[model samples]
Target: MMVKVDRLSYNFGPHWVLKDISFSLDKGEFLFLTGHSGAGKTTLLRLLYGALPVNRGRAQVAGYELNKLKKRQIPQLRRKVGVVFQDFKILPRRTVFDNVAMALEVRGMPRPHLERRVRAIVRAMGLETKSYSICERLSGGEQQRVAIARSMVANPELILADEPTGNLDFDLTMHLMDIFKQFHTYGTSVIMATHSREVLDCVPEARILHLQDGRIVTDSEPGLEEDVQ
Candidate 1:
C-alpha cells in the first residue's frame, strides 16, 4: 500500500476539524477527495504530507508511520511524496526555473542534472518561456502551474494536490488535469482534493472520497471504509 489510515482525527485547540477517518490507497491508484471548503480536505492532505502532526490516529504514507514520525524524518518522508498546495507557495521573488529546481536542489541533485530536470518539467507545464520570469509577476494560473512544475519535477512516488485547479478556468484546468493524469498513468499515486465536477470527470477511473463536516460521508473506493466518529 502507498497509503493507509485508520481512525484518523484532528483539531485546532478545542475545536475539531476532522473526525475519525479511515482509508487505504494502493500503489498507482488515483483518488479524488471531494468536499466543501471546511470539510477538512486540506487538513487531511496536510496530515498525509507530514505538514501537520498526526496525534489521534494511525497513518502510514510512503512507508513512514506519520503519527510516530519525527521532525528530522519529515524530509525523508517528503522525498517520496510531492505536494501542490491550494495556495501557490513558490518564492515570490524567484524565477520559475529557480522555483522548480529547488525541489531537486534539496535532494543534493547535481546542477547539470537538476537544470535539465527543471527545464523539462517547466516545459511540461507550458512555462518554458517564462522560466526566467519572476513568479510574483505571473498570472494566478501561471503561478499555479509553477507550483505544479515544482512538485512534479522530482517524480516522486506519490502526489498530494489540494484543489490544484481551483484558480484555473475550464480550458486551463483541463490542460493541467491532463498533465496530472499523464503522471498517474506512469504509476504515480495521486490523491487530489477538488470541488470541480469537471476535474473529477477528467479521470473516470479514480476513486472519490466525499467529506462532510470533517467526516467521510462516502468513500466510493474499495479497501477504504467510511469511519465517522
Candidate 2:
C-alpha cells in the first residue's frame, strides 16, 4: 500500500476534525475524497502529506511511519509526496520554469538535471510556451497547471490534491483529470479531494470515499473494480 491510516484522529482546540479515520490506498490506485464544506477532507489530506502533525493513531506513506517522521526528515519525506492545493501557490515574481525547478533546486539537484526534468514536465503539462511566462500573468487554468507541474515534477510516489479543479472550467477540468489518470496509469498513487461531481464523473472508475461529521461514512463499494480502471 502507498498510504495507510490506522485509527487516525485530530482536533483543533476542543473541536475534533477527524475521528478515528482508518483506510489504505494501494499502489497505482486513484481515489476520490468527496464531502461537503467544513468536512474533514482537507484535514485528512494535510495529514497524509505531513503538512499537519499527526496527533493520534498510526499513519504511513511510502514506508515512512508518520509518527516517527522527525522534524528534520519532514522535508525529505515531502519530496516523495506531491501535493496540489486549491489556491495555486506560485511565486509571483518567478517564471513558470523557475517555480517548478525550485522543487528540484531545493533538493540539491544539479542545475543541468533540473532544467531537463523541469522542462520535460512543463511540456508534459502542455505549458511548453508558458515556461518563460510570469505566474501572475497566466490564466487561472494555466496557473493551476503550473501548480500541478510543480507538484509532479519530482515524480513522487504519491500525489495528494485538494480541489485541484476548483479554478478550472469544465473542459479544463476534464483535461486535468485525464492527466491525473495518465499518472495513475504509470503507477503513481493519486488521492484527490473535491466536491465536484462533474469531475468525478469524468473518471467514474475511481473509488470515491464519502466523509461526513469527521468520519468516513461510506467506504469504497465492492463492485467498484469494474468502474475503476
Candidate 3:
C-alpha cells in the first residue's frame, strides 16, 4: 500500500478537524477526495505529507509512520512525496525552467542531466516556449501548469494535489485532468482533493472518498450513492 490510515484523528486546540478516519491506497491507485471547504480534505493531505503531526491513531505513507516521523527526516520524506497546492505555489520571480528545476537541483542532480529532465517535463507540460518567462507574468492556467510541472519534475512515488483545477475553466480543467491521468497511467499514485462535479464526471473509474464535517461519509465509485459512515 502507498498509504494507510488506521483510526486517524487530529485537532486544533479544542476543535477537532479529523475524526477516526481510516483508509488505504494502493501503489498505482487514483483516489479523489471530495468535500466542502472545511471537510478536512486539505488537513488529511497535509497529514499524509507530514506537514501536520499525527495526534492520534496510526498513519503511514510510503512506508513511513507519520506519527513517529522525525523533524530531521521531513526533507527526505518530502523528496519522495510531491504536492500540488491549491494556490499554485510557484515562485513569482523565477522563470518556468528555474521553478521546475529547483527540486532536482536540491537533490544534487548534475546540471546537464537536470537541464535535460526539466526541459523534457516543461515540454511535456506545453510550457517549452515559456521556459524563460517569469511566472508572475503568466496567466492563471499557465501558472497552474507550471506548478504541476514542478511537482512532477521529481517523479515522486505519490502525488497529493489540493484542489488543483479549482481556478481553471472547463477546457483548462480537462487538460489538467488529462495530464494527471497520463501520470496515473505511468503508475504514480495520486490523491486529489476536489469539490468539482466536472472532475468527478471526467474520472469515473477513480474511487471517491467523500468527506463531510471531518468524517468520511462515502467511499465508492464515482456516482454511486453508497454511504460508508
Which candidate has the top score in lDDT? 1
TM-score attained by model 1: 0.94
Give residue 59's error in model 1 in angstroms.
0.5
Question: By summed lDDT, which 10 consecutive residues of candidate 3 come out lowest?
Answer: 220-229
Error of model 1, residue 12, in angstroms: 1.5
Looking at model 2, which ten-residue stretch has the lowest summed lDDT? 220-229
Q: Which residue runs does candidate 2 get wrong by more than 4 Å?
A: 222-229
Predicted structure 3: lDDT: 0.89
Report the lDDT tens digits of candidate 1 across residue range 20-64. 999999999999998777899999999999989999989999999
Task: Name model 1 segments beyond 4 Å from true.
Answer: 221-229
Model 1: worst 10 consecutive residues (lDDT sum): 220-229
Candidate achieving higher TM-score, 2 or 3: 3
How well is each residue in 148-226 modelled by candidate 2, as lDDT tens digits? 9999988889999999999888887888888898888889999999877677776666788788878887777424422
Give the per-residue lDDT digits (tens) of candidate 3, residues 179-226. 888889999999999888888777777999989988888888876845
